[model samples]
Target: MRCPLARMTAETPLRYRFVGARGVRAWIAAPSVAQTQTPPRPLDPTEVETIAIIGRPSSQIAETLRRKRAAEVISDGVSAEQIGDLPAANLAEALQRVPGVAIEREVGEGQFVSVRGLGPLFQSVTLNGAPVAFNENIRNSTQSGRQFRFRALSVDLLAGARLAKSSTADMIDGGIGSNIDIETAGGLDGGPFLALRAGGEIEERTESLRPDLSIAGRIVSPDGSKGLVAGISQEDRRVRYDRFQIMRYGAFAVSGAPLTAPNDVRTTVEREDRRRRSAFLGADWRVSPNLKLDFDGLVSSFDNTIREDRLCPPSAPLRQIEGSV
Candidate 1:
């Protein structure tokens, strides 16, 4: 009919531990006696404490999630939580805390992270263990190497994100920098989770405002066997730079003697505005207790326009005039 209830202790998280039968059972407190099955006691202080402690139970589910993550990690890694709760303009800056992690910044904002001093081309970025496309939000699309642009990403919806300093056969290939795998929100990660983030920054010189916004969440079935998560992020930024250089052209000889002069000089000012949008989707199903299936997708688009003002002064090399003489 009943058995001694499991004791509540911090050493072992709170969970039902049936000693007797598993089909259907209940908890019954046993009182101390010389040798008796029943004692004359409604409830005692000790028994009362036990019942009260059960009311506030530690979540075994949370512990399960922690252990699962630990099992999935095989090498030295950096998780999003390791990034700490601090002010970061982009994911690249958030990753700076990881050992051997370096980031490249564009217009004072982090754009890419290099692992172990290796450049982005050496690193591979993945979403939920799947490769995300290579769409960098930068002025130069011609930039080389395989890399993900951190500037276009928002970190609000990740269940877990990690950069693996090493790799195994199970991991996807092509990351000389590091293999950075990001896990999206899943049914087990949370219940009815919703997150919204928005922020703005002002440029000192141009006095222009840059804005970013994102929303993400996950919804799960009642049994926690299936779930779906999706998110979208948008950002607008403006950048400026100035440069001056002397243009060199072929020069003529001066009176048959060798001579050369700068042919032209120019000063240029440039300004660029970029709008980037990124989105992600995730779905998972626990097919039968052991077999599980998951899907994740990521897409990004960037539109950048640049304006330039240039002034060039024309000059002729004196070598030509000397050769004529």
Candidate 2:
């Protein structure tokens, strides 16, 4: 049976009823209902096709997740694409994005890394599962630990970096905080790849523009059994620093209490010229599915030259300077 409301039409007339003294006080009008129509049926499914999407950024993200999941210990990885996306000057700066990772800066660039609130001495750095020699600036010998300086290496020479926070049986023993493994791409990792970069940066204080150039490429054999990767980069930069120095502090009696004042005030201006060059070569050989040999070698050089000028202003003698105490 159809509903009563559904039988109502739009053309229904109005009706009025009069009570004893009210006289046609209330007037009722027929209610109008909107018609409802059935919705269209969905189309039938035809055929199913598979689509594979591959991109540099997306592939790198997928690979990072895969590496993180496959590791037996607690590990985090940063891909080259991710590192390149950031405005970092060195590998140490790029690594600051990872959890529990911190960097030490020198000369306005990241030089060392500390992991999990521990100093660099407690952390170990390796390249392709092998220990790399520690490289430091000759001018500074204060860093006498077995720490690896990240500033010595360029980010363009790396494919990815992984930090393992937990210990495992197959790892080296020196890392009490964490172990960092730097990975390089194999020649066949991507069919064929080449990158070239040339740019210039201007210093704020000096207003001088410096040039930076880098080139990297990979070549692989037909059978994909052998591959070679090589990259080189050079950067020339000039940095200036202005600082105020207080050689000593002295106490003087003012009114009734002793007051502290700076003694031997001096101003210094320092200009530094830095030149860095880095190169890396990698080889991947798949002798068999179970046995493979990978070789990665890196060479880097850094030159630093600094010139400084100082100006000192004479102050009152310490013996009677504002009633010394």
Candidate 3:
């Protein structure tokens, strides 16, 4: 049975109630019930369709999960994830769990990355699918500009990171072992949100303390047609390394084995004071459904001073020269 003017009441027989074409509420009852209420105008077919669609789903990891899953399905290898979802503070530390990856650090900072057991020389890195070229002529007898310096990159502005193992024609050249692409976040990618993080660390061996901070935010237009995002991160750190070296393999030869006691080892100590910071800005405009525009830029700076003291018997008698010998 139907009711002409059903109302929200203490005892409504219908499981659900809805307003009909008229002003009267529609409901189901055992027997017909009619209430005198003014008739309403009819709803247009377009209005009914518009009211049927609901809002979109929301989740922090939704977009990243989709991309990673899509890549897994479309490509032969690799995965991707948002940087904020990573457990480590730096890209190097985060990549250690990415399987077939290794990290090398200098003075307690990740200096380089190795993939598939190959050294950094075979590994290539890029920012937003473009190789970050380095000067090979400036190599100080040690570096040949084979890989990007991980220590110089800041994780604060990272939107997402991916490890591409399978080679593709569109991928930037240079990766023999593996290719890593790091994308920065901003504008529509970040959406309308604010993120703040602060932490500190103390190294007992170094007998020093350090502080870390990061701030990021994204603002979008009322209709979400335009947006801007910006962020900054800074950290101060001190590290110390002290150890003893055997000096030479001949020191362990036969009779020299007994002469190669720990006391005969050379002693060295080094201390480094480091400061790091990263800043980024981004803009996005959805001019139309099929056309859009995006602009992003980032800069990172690292400054450090190192002091070393060494007591190696033979080398102690001579002064060491700096720069290429």
lDDT of 1 at 270: 85
Which parts of model 1 have CA positions greater than 4 angstroms off? 1-84, 134-144, 244-265, 316-325
Structure candidate 1, residue pairs in collision: 122-177
Model 3: per-residue Cα lDDT over 192-218, one tens digit each: 888898988888888776999999899
Q: Give the lowest summed-lDDT range of ten residues in model 2.
A: 3-12
Candidate that beats the other on TM-score, 2 or 3, i.e. the better one? 2
Question: lDDT (CA) for every model shown?
Answer: 0.69, 0.82, 0.70
User: Between candidates 1 and 3, which one is better according to TM-score?
Assistant: 3
Full candidate order by lDDT, most accurate first: 2, 3, 1
Which pairs in model 3 have colliding backbones?
none
lDDT of 1 by residue, 90-114 (tens): 5678777666788888767788888
TM-score result, candidate 3: 0.66
Alpha carbon lDDT at 79, candidate 1 = 42
Tens-digit lDDT string for candidate 2 (77-179): 7989999987778889999999999998988899888899998888888888888876453335665578787887778888889899987877778889999
